[model samples]
Target chain A: MSWEKVFFALLIFPGLLYAVPTAWLMLWLERKFRARMQGRIGPPFYQPFFDFVKLMAKRRVLRPSFDSIFMMGLPLVSVSAGLLALALLPISSDSRGFAGDLVLLVAFLEVPSLCSVLAGFASRSIFGQVGATREAILSITYNLPFLTAIVALAYSAQSLRLVDIAASPAGGVRALAVLTICLCLPVKLRINPFSVSNAEQEIYSGPATEFSGPQLAMWELAHGLEWVALTGLVVCLGLTFRTGTWIGDFAIYTSLSLVLVILLTILATGTARLKIQQAARFYWRWGMGLSLVALILGVFPDIERFIR
Target chain B: MNIFSVLLKNLRMGPATLRFPEEVPYPKGFHGPVKIHTEKCICCGMCAYVCVSGAVRVAEHKDNCEWVYSPGLCTFCGKCVSVCPVEALHMAAKSAPSYFNTKALDEVHLVPYSPCPECGRPTPPVREVLRAKAFKGVAPNVLVKSLICQRCRQKDSQRALVSIQVKGEPPPSRSDK
Candidate 1:
């Protein structure tokens, strides 16, 4: 890709401009939906943006032992990883299709959580330490099923390229694979019930406790961008419907994401936060179980074809 | 009960939060600030006495009777309103608005005292004294006697006791003590 194309993809098209705002909007939607469910008036549409601005305006404070450079840089690294993942995803059937992009996307998806772990360790706070440990354990618990679900999708499409996956018609096994992904997304996103890593009530924002000012703002931004990337991935891999025009395709993609977001919000509001042990057990049992079934279903192409 | 069902029910019912500031309707009987009707207030000091937070101050002097309320210190318990003898105080359903400066929150209402009929000295507000008399079930004659200043009233009481002693009647036992 040319430098201009790289810049456009990374900073404009599917990167900072597109991903950041969309993620902020999605976070706002989650808050509003949850508040409504609890019979309360939630914050306005601009609340997320306001919070970001407020965080940016705050004074930066660093601990004596912490490396300021590493602490500040990790959030950017996470955001870049998410943007790269989005760029790798072919938005339409005619878009570029790279080999083994699915594997690359999965690896990129893990970077944000890994960054959180590193950040937590770097902070040297007790809450940060505990939060990092929880995140590490959660990453382990959810990554297997998440990756397995993706592999199941790949097996169904017979290609690791995202474009092929989007182009193919979704069937029973693929639908189950999508369901497995849907279940795991909440855990990955740290939404309610599966929000053991952050566990705000217990740990006071967990891994993000010590980060302040621009660093904290970037972390929040990275989280939002990650939301876009991961949800966009789900939409691309599971709910993509091509139209001849880019606008139509983009609209469908956004609409599907809205549906997924609504579903996730409802689930979040309905359930209480789970303990770390409970979360692990839940993933090991239900998460792993569903993905295993999807995997079994995907392995038998004849069966999937017959079902279709 | 499934959470999904609860969520669905809540969605159907809509939000429970009021659109405050734009539509400032509070629930019925909601305890807010203590509202004083200065005209009805007899300065009986019941509200001041009952106030737990020391937000109410009823100062009755020779020259003036003042009822001061500090909204900043008010607990909004409605105890003062409940204890008011003449129903001068009631809990308004609107809270005190926040102020940038602290001094704005303190409110003072001063009612000048009425002169004593005989001694021509400053006394408690006439309306307040009358209300207190009525609330305490004092007879008209006793109410008249209570209008005198402390020194004159004491002298009058002493003269009455001497007259009673001369009449060979035992003075009424000091029940107030």
Candidate 2:
């Protein structure tokens, strides 16, 4: 790929410039939607933006000399990784991503989470350490379904390129692949039911308990970008319409991502937080079963023909 | 109904909470900070006596009675208002504003003491409301006796007895001589 094209992909549409504002908007919408459901007036529309700015202006927390640099680097790394992951998405139809780019996307998607697990331990706070450990355990449980779903989609397309898999026709296997992946998003995003690690009532802010000021702001930005990058994946695979124009496809993608956000908000608002053991059981039993079925069908696409 | 139905109903019904923090209205029968009506207060110290939290304090000076009430110390139990003799203490409709200094939040009222006309001694002022309940338009002489100090009033009664004992004679009391 040309350096100019690579820079445009990483810095322009579907990248940092587009994702930052959209991610913050999505976060605010989630909070507002939940508040309304609970019969509250919620916050003003500018609340998220104001909060981000205020946090950025606050003084940084004093940390031990040995840990200050290590603590500050994690959020920066996560945010960079989150932005990199978003750039890999083929929101535009003329995506020139290379072969096995799906593996790159998945690898980039895991970076923020791995950094979070490290952050919790590096903070030297009891809450942070406990939150980090829970995050570590939950990640292991959720990745089973996440990886299998991607593998099934790749197998069905007979190619490892995300663009090819996204272009595949809709069918039972593709639908199941989407379902399995959807089940993992809540856990990955740390929303209700699977939000045991970061439960405010239980472990404070999970791995981010000790981070403050600019560090905390970066962590928040990374989380918002995660919302965009992950949900954008769902939007890519789920949407099939095309008007043979860039702007038209972009509009469709944006609207679908919004709809998915609303659906996720409803799911979060209606469900209560789950205990760690309960969350693990739900994933290990139900999630493991669905992922196995998708894997079986993926490894043997001819089995669908035989069963029919 | 499920959460969706409830959510829709709530959305249609509008928010159950106030839009602004200051917009929340005090509930009915909610007792707030104590407010004293300086005009009606007799400074009988009944409020201070009944206050369980020691929120109400009465300080008696030679010329005036100082009534101090701190909302911070007040339990908002309304006992002090109920025990007030002249209906002087009543609670405000809303709680006091944020507290920075405790002394600044105290509601202070200085009720002037009425001096006895005969001996220039300070006496607890009986307001019209208390006077109406204590005496029902008694004779002028009786009213005059109540208006003076006890020492001066007792001397007048003693002089009347001596004069009654000796007809056309001056009283034997040293002051009369």
List the DockQ of the predictions in order: 0.66, 0.65
Per-residue CA lDDT of model 1 for A177-227, tens digit only, reads: 888888888998998888887988899888998899889989988888778
- Native-to-model Cα distance after best TM-score fit, residue B19 in candidate 2, in Å: 3.0
Return the clash pairs for model 1, or none. B42-B128
Candidate 2: tens digits of C-alpha lDDT, residues A144-194:
888888888898889999888888887667778788888888989999978
Could you give me the TM-score of model 2 versus the true structure?
0.89
Which residues of candidate 2, in runs, are more than 4 Å off?
B49-55, B61-63, B115-122, B128-144, B150-177
TM-score of each: 0.83, 0.89
Instruction: List, in order, the clash count of every candidate structure.
Output: 1, 0
Tens-place lDDT digits, model 1, residues B66-154? 89998888899989988776677888787778888756888888867667777888766446545464536655565676667666778
Query: Which residue pairs in model 2 clash with each other?
Result: none
Query: Best by DockQ, which number?
Result: 1
